[model samples]
Target chain A: MAEKVIAGFTVNVTEEGYLTDKTQWNKEIAAEIAQELGIEELTNAHWNVIDFLQKDYAETGKLPTIRRMKKEGGISTKDLYDLFPEGPLVKAAKIAGLSKPASCV
Target chain B: MKKLLILGAGTAGTMMANHLNKKLDLKEWSITIVDQEPQHYYQPGFLFIPFEIYSERDVVKEKKQFFPKSVEYIQAPIKLIEAEQNLVILQDNTRINYDLLIIATGCKIAPDEIDGLEDGWRKNIFDFYTFDGSVALRNKLREWEGGKMVLHLAEMPIKCPVAPLEFLFLADWFFNVKGIRKNVEITYVTPLSGAFTKPRASAVLGNLFETKNINIVPNFNVSHVEAEDNKLISLDGKEVEYDLLVTIPTNMGDQLIERSGLGDELNFVPTDKHTLQSKAYENIFVIGDATDIPASKAGSVAHFEAEILTENILSYIHGKPLEAHFDGHANCYIESGYNKAFLIDFNYDVEPVEGTFPLPGVGPFSLLKETTINHWGKMAFRHIYWYMLLKGIPIPTVPPHMKTSGKKL
Candidate 1:
């Protein structure tokens, strides 16, 4: 674990930059993380996914997979990819201030 | 007399039935096992079928042959599990009440879940996850002239998560032996960020994949398959063309779980990861691929779960605390082709590391490294699975909980 400054606040994160403590997250922090990951702006579509990921993780103690995000998060696969390019679930979880989705090793 | 019911006579259910048979008092309890299928499949052998290493005969066995004499076996498809009422209704509306229930109804591939996949299924695209699928694929591979072969995994939480990797490794060897290795270009497509999920194992296996000349396309969440175009379309509109497509479709739990309203998004029962008890019902327990426990859905995991589950079930019966806990221990043999295999041992928190198994620094199987001895261990497991594993016989020196003593950490 390492400490990184996001939105003028130092937060604990993994080597890959995923937040170690999800509770130390805010909308401002999300924007900063997203910006660092190459997204210049955080849109409502991105917020919807981030909100769903945080709420789902809080309730289930597990990050939702891309399939779960599509089934339960009311987002289509294409839209998810459109919102977070490359790896949707991985990127979305990172921006959402959640640990990386286990996806079952 | 008290009634204890076991559902689905697959590997997990059969082992539980056998474990409880000797442990439970026959005079005080009556054990009944139910399953629709008459033949119990050695599912691990399915991995060998496509490569023609094992036939249908080797994997097939009579379900009744393993059951103890005291346990009554019922052959009927279950309609629904009335968890609230502690009743299970069969397809014919046969109602059976139980004091305890063990849900071991394992998962199956739903190829129909993906759009346009059915149109090419068994024609150009094939799956080796099932008996019929493996047999059909074997037939197709028998005469395949060799072209671009793509092995795609539809989603995660699949049964034996390593099977897809094993399939590709074996295919590499199979084609090499058939002298078509030069002609067939193999590509592995996965939804994960890498070849395997765990970092250490992924690095090791990913290197092996490169050494075998297999291409890997990671983070490819498939949106649909375009059978007409002979192309796989990812959610991001990325496409991969293939001459022959072998895919592991989305695996979901038995529909009976869904009908009973006892499952999660994928119809897997919500189970206590450590205790093997159903979170929804006190009288109910879940094991194997049917449980949403975040463990790899493999027979080896089930074998480990059975040991802990047997003790927990007994504790539940006696109204005591569930002491035994499953550590998500999973031991798997990865067939890497050319009569060599890799053995992996890990639990909930541990990833597979290089070490010796059963004995530390002794003359035997090596872990996280490809070796002929590990391949022989995998071959020998067929006998152990049949003669000992299902019969509730403890495998000597191999405990249910993963031991960290020999592990390098």
Candidate 2:
């Protein structure tokens, strides 16, 4: 893990830029990370998804998959793609201050 | 006598029954297994059926033949699992109480989950994930002239995660042998970002795809199948047209899981990844494709899980700690066609890397690289699965856990 400054706050991050310690995240950090990942601005719709992801991860201790996000988060796949662009789950999870969703390898 | 009940007489349940039968004292514990089907299918052979590599006779056997005489087998559909009361009710309304339960009801392909898919199913679209589907696809391939052949995966966490890749690889070799390789256009479409789940394996297999003239369309999360237009439309509006579509549909656990109110959104029981125990109930355990573990849903995974689960069950029964843990161990053989295949060994922590298996440096079977010997090893596994694995007998050299020796880090 390496320390990086995001939104004027230093935090630990993985090599892929995901927050290592989710507790260090805040709204400013999420918006900054989102902007860095090419999401121009965080809309209310975007925040809804981020909230769902963060809440689900905090409760389960595991990042929800794209399927779970669609089914439980009450978001359509089309909307997720529209909100986060390419690779929606990875980008949303990163912005939500969670590790990348683990794919069954 | 205390009762030990096993649901679903498939690979995992059957293995557990055989295991507990020998381990549990007959004077103290009685074992009973339940399933709807009488035939035990060798699921890995389903991949070979489309290529005509194995016939129906080769992959099928009576489920009763594999079970130990001490264990009672009930051929009936499960209606519901009353977890709170430790009672399982059958379709005939027969209720059985158990001191402990093991759920091994595996998953199956659900084509109806996708819009417009059922319209073309068994017509322009086909699947080989089931016995009848494989046989149907074989008949379809036997007479069909070559055209655009698209192999698609509707979603992730399907049983035998590498089967679709293997199917494409074998299809390339199949068409070539049929002298129609030039006439057929082959493509692989998946929601994943690459050819395989692991980065290293994906790179290796991606290079092979290039060599074999196969095309790949990644990150294409399919929204629906347009049967009339012969197109697969993504949620983002991207489209892929095909002459023949071979798809791995959305795989979900048994409907009984839903009926019993014991599953998640996908109907897979919430399970503890390490202990193989049900997260909600202490006496109820889960194994194989039935659980929502992050491991690949394959028979090899179930085999590895059976070993750890047996020890854990015994520990639980004896009022000891559930110390034995499953590391999500999965060993699979990918048939790349033409008597060549690749072997992979991994778990929840380690991704499959280039290594020698079983004997470490002295391996007769190589891992992560294509070899002719691996092909033979895969072929030989059918016999081993029948004679040893399902019977709860350990292989001579292979262990249940992943070994890090002789691996290229």
Candidate 3:
């Protein structure tokens, strides 16, 4: 396990860079993570997705799906991709400081 | 007593052996199946290894486990097939004479045919077709830092043509789980004009690609892999660069087909498309990935061919005109990631159409549409492959022929 220090607080991550603890994730940590992920600034649209994901994970204990985001979170697939060019749900969960989703590839 | 020799105890060979053992008169005939390798693989399971959906042991089994007590299993690599003399020469220089020969010696990946592909194989390039290759790719993907990942197909007529698309879909999901998908730029490069061989299926698959944000680089007839530049040069002078290349190299039939002087330019045995009888030899039949048929090189096609070939072989033995005919029928489950998959069933004449499968209106599976039921169907097939299909038991509802009863248009 590799640990990343955010605001002088240590956070453990898996070898693949997924955060091990959900509690260590904060708004400040997300901002730093977003910048590191090539998103220089976090827009309101990005926060909407990130905040929804955090709430969804806390409630369901499952990562919100792409369809769920599009339907419930009011985010379109295109806009989701635009926001997180790599992947929407994946990056949203990461930016929100959630653990890796348990979906089988 | 007459001898029936079947080469390569893979999917086609194993099914034929089991099928014939029950049909043939044991008192008057001897059946022998040969292969250099002793392990049998449920090849479809190979695609799931890199995604961590299936482990290595889940896909491998002893070749002898599928064979019955009556069939002879020879574990030796074949050196040559003397088609004229009806003799198969082993690598040890021994000869086995047969009255009828069945060539199921399937195709293999030929990376050497592509220039510079070997230069970075297993380093920056990998394939999930073979067991070792799949395992190596699993490790590479597990530790893969985000970069431009390109999944490519060198040519068509490769085994399990839908596999590359499945890999792409799984990669989308895999990277998502790893939390580095944002760092990865995924692209699919193919020789075809679209995502698949068939137009209807291609349209559906192409849409999936667009929604997934995976780039599509079609009609790329690869000339070579310029490893130094990290570019795949097409014959048309086009190039696509990537940091990691996972390719399905040019696939060719077994070397034994070439040694026997019985194969086409690509070393696939030329045969009657419907009858599966070799064009050159009357007593010889070819099936599976070894034949130069227009059907998809897949296990389902082989299973379908085995049913027709078994009947044709019996007809030939009795000096009867061959009655059963293969329709080049093939069906496959395409895993579309996110625990959903789609099913496609087609033949030489039909493209995959939208509808329900097995039961027209009451399908537990859908055609050309992704569903969780389809994913379960794909998972359940592993057991069906080992217990029923390879064992030659008739699979219910799924016949050897492609019927249009359930298809929409």
Candidate 4:
């Protein structure tokens, strides 16, 4: 996982297909995913959080925990769910450079 | 005995399956039918859907419901067909071997084929061919106040030839009933050089277009739809501006037909001009929109061909010579709106002539003529199609061969 800031928010980016192993996506595909995520824009403030999330998930086998999200990304469970209606934390985790947990779906 | 596999459970295939199921004995032979989609759409009802005359419930039925009970139904996606090997493979890796194959797969919509069509499609512009599109248009019409409205045919070889015209006519009626007739300007755009394909019918209906104040944009080949500008620009750059754009999207054949490499550029199977047999393979036959026959691709044409092809299949079963005897016969009822409709019956050689049908001069229905009886006949066909056509039961009074009786010279 590659932890990076995207659209003023922390997101973990990883290779496609694995819960833990995410691939490096280019700016265009990243922007498309961001648009789908309602982020739409990639700003300097978002870079670090996205990079950290990506790096942490890449280093570890799972996405950042809520405690980690609160400590690192400054987002609550409610704020996470608000971003991803299907459970923002879990759903955005799909695009956030993290692994898709089997039980998450 | 040779195995027979039928593709598609649509109008033609379902009817053919029922017809063949009754004739072929299972003790000596095996019969199978393959189709991807489980639901069978009442295609004709798509016309009424936009006007809220019919709902999604009325336009759709399960394909399995209309299929013959005895035939093996393979509800799976077709991967590819190796005509040379006389086999069709499914996506599941199941191979269906057929000594005789019937391609009843119908034509499909190809909106992306045209330039800029994909942009406005279903959003700024609409097509009533599909269930979703029709229902969407219905919803759009609900909130619509009124403006320049256009009923345009992108090109010919559409499923129902009269449907676009019928839409325009019905729109007029619908607007009038809603008391928005004055606020809206209705236009009928076509690529044809005249009001219709046939000259006699064109002169009559063309006059009606004039009288009803429905602007006719004849010979306009649409190049693209400028949604932001709210204009339909033709190939020559002639533009028709509209507030609500209702277009009949381009129609093409199935993708499986393309994968099989047995079809033309449009994926419609190349078939015998007269015999209705597949040109690529000897043991294969085709009917309906799936075939590249130079005939009007309509339900009536399929009904006409079914009567003739049954005899041909019977001959083939007995190891006899195949029959080359099907004139491209088609019959359609033109809904002129206001409780009146005109019936047109003709073949490849004969254009629709003004006359009494069935028994000629003594008949109840008139051709190229509109009456209350014709409108009733059109409505009554819904019942007949469900009971007779899909069941493969014969239609009384009307025959496959078109009659010229009561028709004046």
Q: Model 1 Cα RMSD, Å?
A: 1.9
Q: If both were scored by TM-score, which would come out higher, candidate 2 or candidate 4? A: 2
Candidate 2 residue B58 Cα shift, in angstroms, is 0.9
Can you write out model 2's per-residue Cα lDDT over A1-105, one digit (the tens) per residue?
Answer: 589999999999976688878789999999999999999899999999999998886655566667788888898877899998877877888899987654443
**Which portions of model 3 show Cα errors greater than 4 Å?**
A1-105
TM-score of each: 0.95, 0.95, 0.79, 0.77
- On DockQ, the leading prediction is 1
Q: What is the DockQ of each candidate?
A: 0.47, 0.43, 0.01, 0.01
Which residues of candidate 2, in runs, are more than 4 Å off?
A1-29, A58-63, A97-105
Q: Which lDDT value does model 1 have at B66?
A: 99
The order by descending lDDT is: 1, 2, 3, 4
Model 1 over residues B115-200: C-alpha lDDT tens digits?
99998999999998899999999999999999999999988779998888899999999999999999999999998787866566
Q: Give candidate 4 misplaced runs (Cα > 4 Å).
A: A1-105
Clashing pairs in 3: none
Model 3: DockQ against the native?
0.01
Question: What residue runs in model 1 are displaced by over 4 Å at the alpha carbon?
Answer: A1-15, A20-29, A102-105
> Model 3, A60: alpha-carbon shift in Å?
58
List lDDT for all candidates, in order: 0.90, 0.90, 0.85, 0.75
